[model samples]
Target chain A: MPALVVQWIVALVMLVGAFFILLASIGLLRMPDLFLRMSATSKAGTLGAGLLLVGTIVHFWDFSITTRTVATIIFLLLTSPVAAHLIARAAYFDGVPLWEGTRRDDLRGHYHTSTHTLDSVVRPAPDTEIPEMEGDDFPEEG
Target chain B: MMLDVLWSAILVMLSAAFVLAFIRLVRGPRLPDRVIALDLLTIVVMGFIIVYAVRSGQAAFLDVAIILALISFVGTAAFAYYIERRV
Candidate 1:
């Protein structure tokens, strides 16, 4: 392909990537809680960074850089969600409060303090109404 | 010529985004919020580095970007663990 065309392509891709990054940052700034911010950053930030790397790959179009770019993209795709999950899990277990408007939290009663694990047995049935608990149905016995 | 203009424009927007994210990172009320902001800042920095690499025609910077992504991923995960374990 022509150099000019390649350059335009790079420019376009980079612009789109930059837009996503900006959107993610805005969401991060404005979102109410840790979970919402995590949701924003993980998805938009990954796609934005991936697109930027894609622009780099297209610009270089060489063997080594291409390999590295592909590796970087894959690493990002794999790790970002994992990182978000870990952080959100930590926040939840550490008792970070959710937004007031959050309707249903499936994991609310499923977590076992004794085992430090989620008891999947109490997993709410699909389409079943979530009961409003008074407090600590499963009492912590230490 | 046009490509240079486009890249420069994109770089300016990215810098603005970075500054806003930094503000959030500094002012975030909670630990996880701060961590999320930190993650965004790393990504923006990576984007900046890649743009710089493109401008300078240096493939070495791409290598740096890869290393950065690796380090940030690990760092974020470790921090999350510390928050959870509280140790």
Candidate 2:
């Protein structure tokens, strides 16, 4: 009876995980922009993978396998958000256009292309003039 | 008996998901779109590896899944860096 119950639980967990993964892939296909796709895939993909790892732990009921499964889950959870953020920030700076339906973009006009800096507030114009350095501050030319 | 059927169904669903993600990878109009598709593909492949490990009763394969996850994260980060640094 216990074995039967375990089987059912594992099956249910795997089914749900697989469904979530499939939903993420579908979202990746259907989303209108890179950011939207990242939003869909990163969250759903991590959850799905984590759930599947949990199912593996339950199915095996072994100590080493459980440890590895937990490690994989933790790593996925830790890295997925960072990876998504990096990709999205890069994509935005690389000029990947947003969807037409996107109503607001707070980062627009605040990002300095040359310096790769972001200002908290949009400046009237990017300061192109280099402030004159004092004699002591300026390095001597070779 | 039922467990066999369920596993097979899950595998099929994952394969379909992989196909859909691959379609996006192929049809991408921009590099980021392709990168996102590749990331999704790695995720789907990870799920596939985990499911196979469960089905085959080979705990060894779980290691492969873990390594794959690590590699995918590294690959995504590298691609992001490349995109950011592009002239």
Candidate 3:
């Protein structure tokens, strides 16, 4: 590849990658609701990173970066849906209402509050902040 | 020469995905929100890795890329499992 052509290619790819990242930010900030936002986050991030990684590979073409980028994409593909599912499940279990336009919530009746326990990690940020840790004694053993 | 053009084009498309994902990552109202973002971050990193491989002409890095892809899945899975199974 000619130096001029390579330089042009690098510049173009980088610009495009940067633009996509910015767009994801916009979607994150502007989206109206949680599910919608999560949708954007998962799909957008995956795509954006994929582009950037590919760009890096094209520009640098090293073992470390190539491995890192591919790993990144594959990881995103595997986990994004799983995490989304968990979050959605948690939201449903804890009684977070879906958007008003939503027509059905089948899980509401099927999975009662009694069946699934709500862990803090699954919980969204609560309105009131928890008080700071107070003095506590260590456990004693016989 | 032509290979480089195609690769660059792919990056352009990937960039779009990155921003959209970032948007959601930042605005998510729950724990999974951050997890989702982090997950996306890994993907974007992967893209760069691929691109770097092309530019630097290091064929060996592909192996590392594969490993990263594997580990990231595991990391995400662990979190998912914790969220699903934890008391």
Whole-model Cα lDDT per candidate?
A: 0.87, 0.86, 0.58
Q: Write the per-residue lDDT of candidate 3 for residues B1-87, one digit (tens) a residue.
A: 865666556566556556666665666666555665666666565666655655666756655666666676677667656665653
Query: For residues A1-142, what per-residue lDDT tens digits would candidate 1 score against the true structure?
Result: 3398898999899999999999999999988888888888899999999999999989989998999899999999999999999999888877787776666577876766444587877755354344465545455779
Give residue A80's lDDT in candidate 3 (0 to 100): 61
- What interface RMSD do all candidates show, one decimal each? 1.2, 0.9, 6.1
Highest-TM-score candidate: 2
In the range A37-140, model 3's lDDT, one tens digit per residue, is 66765666556655655666566555776576666656656666776676666545434445555544334334434456434343324442322332332335
Model 1 spans > 4 angstroms off: A121-142
Give the per-residue lDDT of model 2 (tens digit) for A1-142.
2388898898889889999999999999999988998899999888888889999999999898899899989999999999999999898878787776665666766877776789888763554332233344334669
What's the candidate order when arranged by decreasing lDDT? 1, 2, 3
Model 2 DockQ, alpha carbons vs. true complex: 0.73
The predicted structure with the larger TM-score, 1 or 3, is 1
lDDT of 2 at B18: 97
Sorted by DockQ (best first), the order is 1, 2, 3
All candidates: DockQ: 0.77, 0.73, 0.23
Chain B TM-score, model 2, reads 0.93
